[model samples]
Target: MDDAANPLRIPPQMSVYADKHNLFHLLQRMLTGLLIDQPEDPISYLVRLLQAADVPKIMLLGPPAVGKHSAAKKLSAELGAVHVTTDSLLEDQSELSAEARQYALTHQEIPAELLIQLIKRRLNSVDCVDKGWVMEGVPQTFLQALRLQQAGVIPQHVVMLEAPDDVLLERARGRLVDPLTADVYHQTFLWPADDAVAQRLEKRRDLPEEQRLADLQRYRREVTALTSAYQHVLRVVNSDQPITDVYQQVAAFVKTRRYYRTPRILLLGPPGSGKSHQARQLSEKYKMVDVSCGRLLRAAAADGSAVGDEVQPYLDGGTPVPDPLVLKVLDKRLSRLDCCSRGWILHGFPRDLEQVRSLQESQHRPNRVYFLEVTDDVCLERITLRATDPVTGERFHVVTRPAPNSEVHKRLRTRPEDGVDTVTQELRLYRKHTAALQSVYPDAVHIDADQDFHSVFEALESRLTAD
Candidate 1:
């Protein structure tokens, strides 16, 4: 092995294990604690962090009568997250700042600054932090949203329930509340199944229609700004559906796995699916490392180190290199700073579940995985019929792209690995592993590689910009 190949060679499998068990997130939180407190007893501080409860921070936002209350209540009960609302924060008038108190006493809207102060205090409460919190219908204005963000009241998930104004109006008209339980119900839509609870439902006092319309219009005016402020974490859901259906959608969105934030991209598909071309384009534009496994292995082999010596025989014989050697090379390349900081586009490796499992342990596991799909026949034609110009080292395909002139094409040579027999074998292996590989990356973007290279690259580029 070259001493310079890798200095701090962490085993890749350990990274896989850590990711599987969420140890990466745990360490992240631990580091955050160390940074925040700068505690003298660092180990003890870490131990305390391990024992701290991870409470869910959630926000439910919507227009009046848009089912935010019902959704928030269910989510709070299920996740054991404390339910906080503007009303809950204001229940104790004495806790309010004098400025806010004056507005409340006068039945007038409080200014954003004073309103956020009260919210900030409650959100930072011991209960809210320890048990997690789900806030309902606070910061209904853009300024209030900004004030909460300035106060660091960030939620992991922010859901906005939406419905037509007419639907909300009708629901408001039919709204009922249980005085004993304070659980809201709609007479037409959500009559209690329990006969006793149904009998006690009181028609809640309706805000005068004029006032209600005014409030709705106010919401319409501020909604675009409010949504834009939290766009990254926000999910807008239709609330006109059945309660069960609405809750399921909201719950699913809340529980979905958030992808790693870093821009590591993985490209998968059968060989000759334009992964290499797309990767090069992305690297050129984004300044990310193009970690092509085949290229790296060839480069390593030509370097004449112990690592190169071991893999050169496999390359010369056209036999598959063992997984361990492949990982050894990848672990070294992936650890480089360009890949870590500027980000990476990895293709032509991790061809099966075993490789994906090993990769899971490493922090370099891709957050964005794309699979470019093409037919087996196309793969065969693309790979087998392509010849490299030995003099210029440029590849030309007989069917798609040809050498400029016969004089220039005369020296073109096809490597043994590009032979029809070899390509057929490789395609067979890929076909066997394709399903399991896709199963591991269900969220991976699938692209149509059969199209022209420009279209394929555009599809990949559009998806990258979307993030």
Candidate 2:
């Protein structure tokens, strides 16, 4: 393999992976036969010609502002590969065509179809595909990575960046963004002395420290799932190290791409309850993807693909997509996220005797299964008040005025399964199945979801929170 084909750059936390030499630089030299031209640059490039191997691509995963984006971009510049960030992708109007627009409007997400299309577009670009690229914040989940791979967008390597909780919290707190201009300024380094604009800028005091901690913890949880999925293809890096040391480690990890691991997960729940909401909230909180079966099935249909054939029937039937089919679809979805080292939220599937048995049989079980115990009544009420988007078919509140024309109470009608009478029937079914399900897990908590959402969440939170 020609070293010129692949690039190696030092990242911020290289000391943790200390072996004989910097992995990125060593690999770069081995491949290209040329020493990195500029070691001082944040991004270093090494390409020599053992000469014909495809330059392996690398992804830097870490919580926001952990320098994942900064490191990847620097490396890209040094390596001469196009650097892609989530913000860049988000702002690309050309990529946000009618389909993508509708998806954005409806789902509150960059739909899988849109993502596949975008990856394809990026892969075909003269800069990205031909010379190779360094990407950050793209495949945030097992499913997203799988979508890219299934679409043939596999990365040659992934760098999993981890930091201590204290350092992460400090980083989060020190970070500041100009809300209006979307400009970021780190208090310690970017702030200008005696600059009126900087002085006038205020920290988001409304967002309490606890919230920041919550956000960081949530990110860790999500990333844990993603890491699991792509464990085999990922190289773990501790980003808490000094910037120069970090880069050296990242470069070194890139050199040993084949020695990485892929990640996996097993999340279970029912829909219209708190499953999807919690899944997403937790995923964002953890930095993992919430892979909902319903969402996947819809994406398949929208993409006009064969997966739709099996999924469309369940949707049309107005019934829950079966556990077997859900798992099957998700099994496909899992293959997309090149790595699940970050973890994911498995929403709405794997319910009842068959689903559980099927899940166990497949041997793809969750590290810990959480049975969200929402009463049928509560689930029904929530669905009734939430309006769904016609395009993405996502649910949201149709904020309206209060009292008569004053508006505030108008809402999207509930699904028939969520109607009062249906709820009663469902509750009866749930009661009957609870024993059987609990029998499978002697320790599963039977939460009283009859209480407020916050209260129920508090119960779950206590379990995960350190005493």
Candidate 3:
């Protein structure tokens, strides 16, 4: 048996019958010394203690919106570590050079060469030396991590933090990023104030469904692969626990390793309410997963197996898939990111009253639900903006069209079912179902989608900032 591959290697010396109570306290003592009568600055103490433990160059990875940045800031402040994130870099840029802007638009990752250069640049800075530096949102792949390692930048420890998918999606959905400052606000959890804050923050609306899902899928793949390659240096932690508890546990983990931060959100909304849109943007901005049930189910169905056969009917019929199947699919997809332990953005699934009930029954529920409440007329208008698929001839309201000669419009021109009446009827059904769905989850926040897309996003930003 390969001992390295064993689960025991992941977190050693834990018996099945170990005491559950005071578990965290036990971990804290063993990892970072007893917090009992500890110094006022626990973070600073932990950093010095960890250095004594011979751990340095920590990397933290997790889904976005799970408080990764906050945790990093708090930890850095405590340890006098230099904190670096993409948002900080973007802020310092005068204007994204043509190449940089192109990279942003295309969602091309920060290349390892560029990242390496940036690291060298940062490291040479007076502030970055002596004081340990904590890097966020770089080396998104195993190859990149390897490149850093070969460059003698190997982190002493790596940490991955994750929450349930729904929590991540909700967090993503409720999030508002101030475009000017790159400040984040969660609708019910972390609302911000100040007109300047409000004006600078912008809710993203340009992302399309396919792009959102693709980005999420890509993050799950790349991050997981990267982490696996550094199995020996990694330490995984679940952020699903309460913030205080998660904070304590993670502090302990980093006390022994290098790591990244991941935030999870559970997104909830009406049909075509742009929940998926929000999820993708958050994932890109935060470099996390958008755990979309629709995409997950479709992927499973595309496999053409027994389970896929069962899933095909629901998707093909334009009906909601069952919760059990949704869970099964989610379980499998999430397993792929077991190494990431980063937070994720959960979009789709948990629709209507039954789905909500199902989620509760499974004991996995979103931290929040960001409802995009549009009038029937507004929803109709938004849905009509969509066109048919070029290849399959399937009409969809969410997929992006190329332009006036958009692939979507071109496809609509040829599809037999692309008539105005068909679209109108589909919109009608969408409205009818969503109205009922609203009644089921009465607590869901209502964001007005009747305004211009940016205005709607402004309202969303306002709601989130208010929190």
Candidate that would win on lDDT = 1
Instruction: Estimate TM-scores for all models.
Output: 0.56, 0.40, 0.41
lDDT of 2 by residue, 73-191 (tens): 66777777777765555555683555566655564567776876776676556666457778887677667777675565556678877887887767767776566544455686356
Deviation (Å) of 36 in candidate 1: 4.7
Error in Å for residue 334 of model 2: 1.7
TM-score between model 3 and native? 0.41
Model 3 worst lDDT window (10 residues): 10-19
Q: Which candidate is the best by TM-score?
A: 1
Residue 95 of model 2, lDDT score? 34
User: Model 3: residues >4 Å from true position, as ranges?
Assistant: 1-262, 304-306, 313-320, 338-340, 389-411, 414-445, 452-467
Query: Which regions of candidate 1 are displaced past 4 Å?
Result: 1-9, 33-49, 54-57, 61-64, 77-80, 90-120, 137-183, 191-238, 248-266, 271-290, 294-326, 335-345, 350-370, 375-467
TM-score of 1: 0.56
User: Could you tell me how far off, in angstroms, the CA of residue 334 lies in candidate 3 after the best superposition?
Assistant: 3.4
